[model samples]
Target: MKMLINVPETVVSDALRGLAAAHPDLTVDVEHQVIVRRDAPVAGKVGLVSGGGSGHEPLHGGFVGPGMLDAACPGAVFTSPVPDQMARAAAAVDSGKGVLFIVKNYTGDVLNFNMAAEMAEDEGIQVASVLVNDDVAVTDSLYTAGRRGTGATLFVEKIAGAAADEGAPLERVEALARRVNESSRSFGVALSACTTPSKGSPTFDLPPGELELGIGIHGEPGRERRAMMTSREIADFAVNAVLEDLEPTGPVLVLVNGMGATPQLELYGFNAEVQRVLGERGVTAARTLVGNYVTSLDMAGCSVTLCQADDELMRLWDAPVQTPGLRWGR
Candidate 1:
């Protein structure tokens, strides 16, 4: 229960305030809990909006900027943002082209975003949605009907956002998003569980010297819990699962994402192993990102995401991006 905060209820709001202070380029709608780029509604470009719970930092919120999300609605810790929050973001960012919602495949996220999209449409805003379901962990989990969405969310947002930033039409951007999801797969392993600030305790319990395979970001039950193994072995397990699911046979985009507490040194070591495994399968990593992009609060572990990239996808991925969380080549 030991956490640095004034009160449990105010954790998300307080953090949003801090986020606004820390990054002036982002405008925080404190009342609505939506974060957007200061220069929103970019004239003719299709807007990109994505959101979810608040615990995972640098996700939807930190990703709001040029070449990424136009707006991001953050909810309470581990809770889906309300439809009003999303509708406000969509309205604020939508230009003449349209707005695309990047929704993860969780039940609450799907439902809330759907309601928001309908609301936006009622106001004469053209809207499209791309659902991310690249987690090969489970077909039906506690929070989703089909496979859960995880690391591939970053890939979808970045690649599709790049296309949108290039003035691509809403339909073309939506199609690119779907292509990213279709070509991507992910698998995660957890050494420890995360503690939501509101709960003030770990979401799940894992005994020392053990790990949970195929874990979800919300601390949901994974495929299995087993004794701890070496980093190479763990990488083998995760990368193999994604490879088997996708059967990718060409250049791929690789992301070795820390679940929060895992150090960068260890993540690089894990990334090496993942690349080694991919090399054995005759797949080359055209672009690789290692570090904490998507996280599960303070949980310790990592997930591997593999996206089979063609020339167009690779080009889009390498496009300049200027966001708080991910920025390069700008």
Candidate 2:
């Protein structure tokens, strides 16, 4: 148990303090544990709020900015934030228009976020929710809480945020969100495990010459653990799974995401394989983003996200976005 923290309980609070200080444009709801844009309640504009565990940086929190999330609440490391926090977030972000909650498919996340939505509705706030379930991995397995929401969350948030920021109606925003979900698929592999600061040790041990297929963020065991293979082979398996699931005939927005510890060199190497796979299927990668967008803290591996793209999807994707985690041409 070798960790660098003085107190395990203070991890989230301390991190939130630093986050708020670092970004004054966003306000921290200390009581609710949610980070919201300072000028919230933009009249007649749909509000977008999402939340999850704390370990996945730049996810719910780092994404709170222009053309993205309106609010992101933090739970404990890999744990869901409480319903009260979400309720407060919904209430704060809601303008006269409406509110949309983007939740992953995880049981805890769904339950808590839904509870908050229900609570907000009691206050006469119209709330809509879109659950992201993009992982190609089996959900009922023992490793994950359910079909873990992985790479596609980024695309969903970005596109939905763009629509919301554009003052699109709540129905349009929700429709776009579901469109993104229907067209996107994700797959991942793990070479190493993550260490929870509280636990002060790795969550699981992977033998020297093996890998986990369809791994989840909370160190849930993937569908299958097998001997390690070449990056090309691994990419083939992952990309193929997504392709099979999606059966996409057109272009895609490809996201080659490293779990945590996998290096950029490895990511590029894996991308090469993904490129080959895409070429074989007559699928052009219209927009390719490679990095660690969502991670399982310090775990080594990568996930491939295929977002089926059209002209409309591309326009929204290319829209300017500024957030702590992702900023480009804004």
| Maximum-TM-score candidate | 1
Candidate 1 residue-wise lDDT, 34-131, digit = tens: 99999999999999999999878778898999999999999898899999999999999999799999999999999999999999999999999999
**Residue-level lDDT for 240 in candidate 1:** 89
Structural similarity to truth (TM-score) of each candidate: 0.98, 0.96
Clashing pairs in 1: none
Candidate 1 segments exceeding 4 Å error: none
Error of 2 at 130 (Å): 0.5
Q: How high is the CA lDDT of each candidate model?
A: 0.93, 0.88
User: What residue pairs clash in candidate 2, if any at all?
Assistant: none
lDDT of 2 by residue, 1-330 (tens): 565566989888888888889999999866569899998977778999999998888787989988889899889999999999888889889996889999988888889998999999999989999989899888654424556687889999999998888889999999999999889999989998889888877788899999989888788878789999999899889999988899887889999998888999989988999999999888899999988889888889999999999998899999988888887774
What is the total number of backbone clashes in candidate 1? 0
TM-score of 2: 0.96
